[model samples]
Target: MFEVGFWELALVGVVALVVFGPERLPRVARETALWVRKARTMMASVKEEINHELDLQDLKQSLLEQKKLPNTATDNLNQNILRRRQATEILAEQFEPGEAAPEKEPHD
Candidate 1:
């Protein structure tokens, strides 16, 4: 930003008065103020839009991460279930069709 001090502002005002003249200076200054106000409003609107879009991006990213976590968890659960089923099948194979499985020894 430009660091315009009080003297610089006075100098610019004197120049503007000389250039624009007394009759047109007030109108010109008013119009300039209006344009500056409009520019500030437009900049604020654009800044708000950018922040909103960034928030949405963050939300979407978090949702995607959450979605991935559940899928990974589900996949792990399925894999564990499959492993257990395989172990159960192996155990079943150790017993004949009509034979009972051996009783397990209790842990101390």
Candidate 2:
């Protein structure tokens, strides 16, 4: 940003008045203000669009991380179930028809 002090602004106003003359200066100043307003509007819209895109990217990354966690948990749960089933089968094979089943520690 240019640091235009009060004196510099006064100097520019004086020069503009001289160049544009009393009859045209007000119209020229009004048009310049309009253009500056439009430029600010365009810049604000661009900034908003960039912020929205950044938010979307963050959401996508979170969704992917969430997806991975559920899949891992499901895989671990399936493995645990398989281990328990195998332990039950082994115990069945060791027990005779009329004999009481021996107690064993649960599978890890």
Candidate 3:
């Protein structure tokens, strides 16, 4: 990402060794690696949080759509009443001998 090459890295290492000395250089390197690992873990956690929020948003949208369905409680009750009335009419017709079946009840 930094466009750093092998020669550049070697030069930096030589400079670090000269400035910080060998003993301190190893300690500094270890600390730098620790910070890098921590940064990566934090980034991963942030990404997961974002994805989780997105999933929640999608679920909310689907729930909103479901709420907009045409088959509401009143509609379902009306449909049930209509079906029952039809069934009763069909049954009455079957037993009417030669006469026609009665009219169905009004839903309202």
Top candidate, metric TM-score: 1
Q: What's model 2's lDDT at 27?
A: 100
Q: In each prediction, how many residue pairs overlap at the backbone (N, C-alpha, C within less than 3 A)?
A: 0, 0, 0
lDDT for each residue of candidate 1 in 7-108, tens digit (9 for 90 to 100): 999999999999999999999999999999999999999999999999999999999999999899999999999999999999889986899878999999
Global lDDT scores for all candidate models = 0.96, 0.96, 0.91
Off by over 4 Å in 3: 1-4, 71-108
Give per-residue lDDT, candidate 2, residue 26. Answer: 97
Candidate 1, run of 10 with poorest lDDT: 92-101
Off by over 4 Å in 1: 99-108
> Measured by TM-score, how close is model 2 to the native structure?
0.70
Model 2: residues >4 Å from true position, as ranges? 1-3, 83-108
Which tens-of-lDDT digit does each residue in 1-108 have in candidate 2? 479999999999999999999999999999999999999999999999999999999999999999999999999999999999999998878885899767798998
Q: What's the residue-level lDDT of 104 in candidate 3? A: 100
Model 2, residue 6: distance off in Å is 0.4
What is candidate 3's lDDT per residue for 39-107, written digit by digit as tens? Answer: 999999999999999999999999988987756876998999999999999988787877766679999
Minimum summed lDDT over a 10-residue window in model 2 is located at: 94-103
